[model samples]
Target: MPVRNALEALTMRPTRFLLSSWPWRSLAYLTGGALIGITTIFAVLFLLAAGVVLSVLVIGVAGYLATVLSGVAVGRLERWRMRLVDRDELPNPHRHPGAPGLRAWLMCRLREQATWRELGYTMISALMLCWMDAAVVYAAAVVPTMLLFGPVYLYGETSLWIMIPVAACTPVALAVAAYPVTAWAGARAAMARALLAPRSDDSDAKLVELSRSRARLVDAFEVERRRIERDLHDGAQQRLVALSMQLGLARLELADGSPAATQVTAAQQLAKETLAELRELIRGVHPKVLTDRGLAAAVGDVAGHAPVPVDLDLRLTGRLPDAVEVTAYFVVVEALANVAKHSEATRAAVSAGVRGGRLHLDVRDDGRGGADPERGTGLTGLADRVAAVDGTVALSSPPGGPTLLHVEIPCAS
Candidate 1:
């Protein structure tokens, strides 16, 4: 019964309607504005005082250190206050890079824009908090009292003006109810703006630079692949073809069955082995199976080879771009390889599906697991490969439990 009521409250239309009304909404907005003003003022003043004390403690040398510390402290405090008032998650504080020497450190600290801005916000917040606290008290208490008492004092009659106090008390009472809600919402918005919003034009510039870098990397990779293909075809392939011809000639000469014929047979066998090795190397460079069969068939081949039992649940119909397919196939192959090599689990499940126009892949193993990114080079390589294609890879493996790898790659429509 209690659960049903709670669920109904979650979907209560009338409650939402009342909250969304103009008068109530306005009161909520005003209250939130007041709380932000108050909090910011308080933060600013506190930072200023702390800065002064630090300056006095270290004098010239300590002043720089103090400023840097003050900035970090202020940023964290503001974020904490935001969480308390607004229930918003904020980004972690940015750390200043450590300099080689004391002078370098001091210079770097002084040069940071965040330090000055945080200090300024702290000073401003202190004054604002004090003023806003007073305003909120007046709005919540004095305004209602005055409205309730004003009419009786002015008219000396409680008949017609009796309703005046009630009318006046209405807004004030609403304001009182709105105070906390306003503070919470405003704090969330301000915190998001301050902590999550890009602080400078450089962030946008960096993104542009990153996109250009990715394009260049892909172009370079294609050029390198062409060069490798040419090398393999002209150098290794030609040598292997000549070797095969030599082996055939040797086999024909070995038909006599003399001691020299036995030597010829050995040479032919060696040549055949060399040719086979060359073919395997070329396949490793870029498998034709991956291109001809698509990601599904390639991944299924990988699953079939796994030492552990693998349940593949793939629903891919058409082909993705060559680059995307190769990347997806390799990601699965590497994940399953890890499962087979590291995960001592009895069974594993691999699933692939398209969701939100992106190819999603998941591999799970029920094994004794403690997979850490820092400990493995295979996972790191896989991560870089996925990132090259603008994909994301996530791994979760707790000690003595199941390990799961999730990957998502954007597909061109």
Candidate 2:
């Protein structure tokens, strides 16, 4: 297996590990940590001193604030430097400020748990961990090199036998040093990751925002559908009704059994059919009954039009959220349409109620049940629509019997 980090490199065969670059990377990591830690100590001391000296002035507050925020910069730099020993990327735990000003940014940072965690890590790294890192590097590299040069360092002071043995053991000592260096580096990176990594609450917040965004889009689309439905119902449907009346009157004025009378009669019939089709199209766009009444009435209107016999068992009390109602209504409509087209069932049933702060819906059919969502049926669309409101779809279909589609949408009635 390939080694992806210092800790994983420890699992390799001894010879293979010694030949790899992990030891050098580990050395670099420790060296960088030592340097950063020493610098942080001095920087923090300077800030503290300045804040004390300027305590009587407004600039002292700036110094104090800078000291508090210093960990943010250290955290960012350390996360980047961690790449030497840990190949995985560390996400910034801090969130973007809602406002653009520096004051807003500072307030936001101060209010976050991650900010304090970073500050604590910063202090620990400077006071303890960095010193340990420096010691590890010194013992691993400097001591081994000194022992390897034993002959040169002790040419006349020590016996030839002692020097020879000491120099001969240099390679073994250096190989052993790699283990401690890599181990310490890996441990330090793990500690840093635990302190600076993004929290679970941050992920939850993002998911909530994403859900709200999808709901907003669904609401916008519903509004457009209502607008189009209104246009068809009030504009084109009215014109068609007037044109049908004019054609009827013209047909009465023509000579009996004449071509003009026949043409007018046919035009009147065509206008009437067109008007009926337009009304259905308007309902499909957005049913007015859904707005005027509630989900129960809207669903009843749809179930009444289903080709197969539909049994409704709705038990909703008042009204649900507009999005929930719209989504539930469409789910029933699509399920019945699927029953008519694919289920081949003579009878279907729809039951809905609000339970435990959730709107529950079950559409079942006693059809030859082998419905496949992958068959380009409307089931996928049904699932997508429910998902827009963070709802769930559950389907049960066996090869020889009944099929059931269960949906749940969250709402406050």
Candidate 3:
């Protein structure tokens, strides 16, 4: 069974929850909060003192920067501390640094809304939140513990008989109060996350931001692919050509029937094969024709290289976004590769066009069906990449022949 956190445990029956560790966790959370509150008090005072003293000198800017940095630390600390009662991950709202330098990072953090909100949390936590947490814990826990042991201390007193019965009911009373105690502590942590993390309005914005980041990553990946392709084409390919020519020259220098001449000929054949494989690798990286032309030509070129005969029918009005093109091209490549590797078919067909402002692709093969994405990462990866661009993939395969994979990606021509 999954262990319930404080908030989850609160939803259980009072008797069951009391038997769990939530009450103890609540107490510990409050105790830790109180300690952190005291630490924040000292930290704030130190920052203020340092700021004032440095302002008297000329380098007050450093002290102000340190204050902002302290707010960042407090925000991160609260995120960590919130795990005491919260089970959900709290995403940091701070933007990444645009450049690689301490000044840039500091400026980015200071400019974020989270930084100011964290500073407010630091103040509130120090002034009131921790005290409130401690009060609830004391009322729910410490008082009950004292009451449960009241008769032990009051033994032999005249009121011992009366206190004993009331003391025995402390367990029931504490269990009843444990619900609100757990709830209040959870609410406080939730409030801290609300203040120190990204606002809920930005949840959809996070998706858009994620899409843009993925696009940037794809662009960087394309750039790196082109760089590698250029290196192989210009460096290794040229050397292989040179080696093949030198071997041919050496063969000519020896007699036609000589053993050294035969060995040189075999070496020349090996060099040519290696050169062909290297060229294939370069094309797989990112074809030059794809960059110069578009996705139609790129898909056709890849289909041409497939061992199985492939028919290509791709039509487009014009160029699409680079990210869309790259994603579509790779998806087709992987699909065709899976077809050639797993599909026991003699032929495959690739068709692409745009419909209703969405690029449509269909790769069909006359192979035995039963392709399961759960069995392989190829289809799953393709679907994920397509979804990253607001696209969808549909696979139709049964226990018979002919499997069809259709993909639609939104793009403006």
Point out the higher-scoring one by TM-score: 1 or 2: 2
Question: Alpha-carbon error at 263 in model 3, in Å?
Answer: 2.0
- Report the lDDT of model 2 for residue 128: 98
Models sorted by lDDT, best on top = 2, 3, 1
Pairs that collide, model 2: none
The deviation in Å at residue 293 for candidate 3 is 3.1
Tens digit of lDDT per residue, candidate 2, span 1-413? 56678999999999999999999999999999999999999999999989989988868888888899999999999999999998889987777777999889999899878888889999999999999999999899787798888799899998999999999899999999999999999999999998899888776766776777797899899999989998898999999999999998888799989988988898999999999999888878888999889999999999999999899999988988989998999999889999999988999999999999999999999999999999988999999999998899999999876999999999964
TM-score against truth, every candidate: 0.47, 0.86, 0.67
Q: Name the best candidate (by lDDT).
A: 2
**CA deviation > 4 Å runs, candidate 2:** 158-169, 232-281, 372-376
On TM-score, the candidate that comes out on top is: 2
Candidates' C-alpha lDDT: 0.65, 0.91, 0.83
Off by over 4 Å in 3: 6-200, 384-390
Model 1: lDDT equals 0.65
**Full ranking by TM-score:** 2, 3, 1
